[model samples]
Target: MESIYIQTPLGIAKIEGDKQGIATLSLVEDVALSNEIPSCLQEAVSQLNEYFSGERNAFDLHLNPQGTDFQKKVWKSLEEIPFGKTRTYLEQAKILGDVKAIRAVAAANGKNPLWIVLPCHRVIGSDGSLTGYAGGLWRKKWLLEHENPMRQQSLF
Candidate 1:
């Protein structure tokens, strides 16, 4: 597996993968930025840069996140979530055909390895509050606002 570290507004992003496609992309606090991106991860780096710059809303790179069957199902469902939108854990469970699986759904979401490519950050608390995010809540908020910048409504 090849890896490359790039600096983002949030922090350094470590991207790892190869011919099988990208297996992981996560933020790190301490990693030297690579002056050159690996051939296998170039596209991912480009898309991620575009995302941070607000030039891209969706990712289209090949992904190969490793996990169990249930986890894979949950991750796949996360991808279906539209850009600039949020879904509650309960809603995600329902979409998976098991509303009672909210806990499991949320757990799987937390374990998602591909980060932004899989869009686990789109999930929010039932009351519309930001919740658990491995990358940290602040990053989650930034991602959400980056996708859908809230506009001020002027009083008429």
Candidate 2:
């Protein structure tokens, strides 16, 4: 296991991974330079930097997000969400052909560990409200506003 930290618009992120692929991305306010990053971490860090700078719309880095089968399903669905679009949990559940599993789908979404890399922030409340982002609702709001093409004035 190896880790590297980089500054992003949201904050500094510590990314960890091995040859298998990137495993964890933890957001922090500061970086600890005590650790040496593995060679494999460079590409992931570069790609993530591009993403935060708005130079990259989608991530191409090899990811090995670890989770349950249902969580994986939800994460994959999150990936399918376009760069600047939002989807409701109910809609996501219906897309999975299980409309009644809305709460389960939301739960799976909440457990998404890869954060912005997995695009879980694209999921919103059924009424188009931001809610339940592990990274915090403010970050979610910022992300949605960042991804919007029109850049509407925010009430926040």
| The best candidate in terms of TM-score | 1
lDDT of each: 0.92, 0.85
Model 1, 1-156: lDDT tens per residue? 999998889888899999999999988876688988889999999999999887998899999989999999999999899998999999999999999999999999999999899999999999999998999999998888888856445689
> Which lDDT tens digits does candidate 2 get at residues 1-156?
888777778877888889998888878765564255579898887787787777888988788888999889888899899999989988899998899999999999888878788888999889988987988999999998888878767699
For candidate 2, the lDDT comes to: 0.85
Shift in Å, residue 73, candidate 2: 0.9
Q: How does residue 53 of candidate 1 score in lDDT?
A: 86
Q: Tell me how candidate 1 scores on lDDT.
A: 0.92
Q: In the order shown, what is each candidate's alpha-carbon RMSD?
A: 2.5, 3.0
Those runs of model 2 whose alpha carbons end farther than 4 Å from true positions after fitting are 29-36, 152-156
Looking at model 2, the pairs that clash are: none
* Model 1 spans with C-alpha error above 4 angstroms: 149-156
Residue 50 miss distance in model 1 (angstroms): 0.7
Error of 1 at 47 (Å): 0.5
In angstroms, what RMSD does candidate 2 have relative to the true structure?
Answer: 3.0
